[model samples]
Target: MEQFIQDWGYIALFLYSFGGGFLALAIAGAFSYAGDLNIYITVIVAGVSNFIGSQFLFYFAKYNKSYMDETVNKHRRKVAMVKTMLKKYGSFMIFIQKYIYGVKTLVPLVMGISAYNPFKYTVLNAIASAIWAIVIGYISFTAGKLLLSFADDFKYVGFFTVLLVLGILVYSFKDKKKVKKQ
Candidate 1:
């Protein structure tokens, strides 16, 4: 498992961060604390992948008018809500979107549809992604160090600590979605 994390962990982190982020990055941070990964490299990989993922969605919506239009029609309320948030907050929405569960990709795509400047989005997204990676990575790394200290005293205990943190994060996010829907 350590070898796998050392080998393909960053790759998995890249893909997971590109898709949804939050949970996977947090896990990587904990792993880094446990010495299974390098936090610096993990943050770098996550930041770059996150930047590319948002860029791809933004450009796809910007250039692919037909598809975006179809998507907008189908998910009109959600898209409209994002558009409203963009208007209300302006480019600040880019930074804020990374933390929001449902709207991370939606914000970028909506920005594209609204004809936001590509270069500006890229610059802002780069900064925001870096910040997101640093913040999330550090927090989880710290949590792992504290919660996983028990593992240092008794090896197997630390592994379960990591798992417990992961399960809690997953459950909390899922619970938030349910509450928001209700």
Candidate 2:
């Protein structure tokens, strides 16, 4: 297991973080604390990937108007909600969306469709992704120490249990949100 992580953890982190992965980054943080990965490298990988992912969304939406129109039309309400957020927060919504559970991808698209400056959004998103990576990685790394001490040989189980509980919560929350949106 340790060998597997040492070999492919960063790769997995890159792929996951590229899509605005939250939980996977936390798992990698704990793995780093456990000596399976390097914390600095882990944070860097996640941050860069997140930046690229967000930039991709922004550009994709900006350049692909026909496709975006269809997508935006399908999720008009969600897109409108993101637009409202953008209006309320301005460019800071780049940072704000990073932490939102279900709308991480939607934000960049909304910004793309609006008059948000591409270069400014890219720069702000880069900063926000780095900040998010550091904060989340450090918190999980710190918690990993306590979880390891508490779980003893069952640290893996503890991690899985925690992930499972979070998954259930997020899944249920999304369902309720979906029904409400409908």
Candidate 3:
């Protein structure tokens, strides 16, 4: 695996990086088996992959408005709120939107569906994805290290940690909304 990555150079790294949230998981696994993987390089690969993948999805969403409308219609109230945030908050929301799971997944689609601005989306998406990749990668990597130190069953423990982080993010966002309404 290490030899393959070394031979493929940046291209191999890019694919692994762009392979969604699982990129970090894969990186952790690779690191355990191969001593050649560097955290900095892994983070860069993940960040670039995230930027490219999200941008691709964002454009797809833009050109396919009817699809977005159909999917988004189910969450009418949330959609309305998101639309308002996009209009008023614009770049800021685009920057942080990628960190919020469901919100992150739908944001590019939402951006595509409403006043689709490619340049703005591209810039903000790059910035946001890079930041998220670095932060999450570091956190996951650190947790993986700690887990490995504790026991041999580190992978499953790390997996649960990732799930826990995702769950907390989702729960907190929902709780925030509930509090806002009350």
Count of backbone clashes for each model?
0, 0, 2
Which stretches in model 1 have alpha-carbon errors above 4 Å?
146-182
Q: After superposition, how far is residue 77 of candidate 3 from its true place, in Å?
A: 4.4
Candidate 2 residue lDDT tens string, 1-182: 78988999999999999999778789888888999899999999999999999999999989998899998999988988888887798888888888997789999888887778898998899999999999999998989887657658787897999999999999999999999999
Worst 10 residues of 3 by lDDT: 25-34
lDDT of 3 by residue, 60-123 (tens): 8788878777888888888777777777887798777756655666667777777777997898
Q: Pick the candidate with the highest lDDT.
A: 2
| Pairs in clash, predicted candidate 3 | 17-45, 18-49
Candidate 2 TM-score, true structure as reference: 0.82
Q: Write out the backbone clash pairs for model 2.
A: none
Model 1, global lDDT: 0.88
Q: Pick the candidate with the highest TM-score.
A: 2
Which run of 10 residues does model 2 get worst, by summed lDDT?
146-155
lDDT of each: 0.88, 0.90, 0.70
Report the number of backbone clashes for model 1.
0
Residue pairs with colliding backbones in model 1 are: none
The predictions' CA RMSDs to the true structure, in order, are: 8.9, 8.6, 11.6
The model with the greater TM-score, 1 or 2, is 2
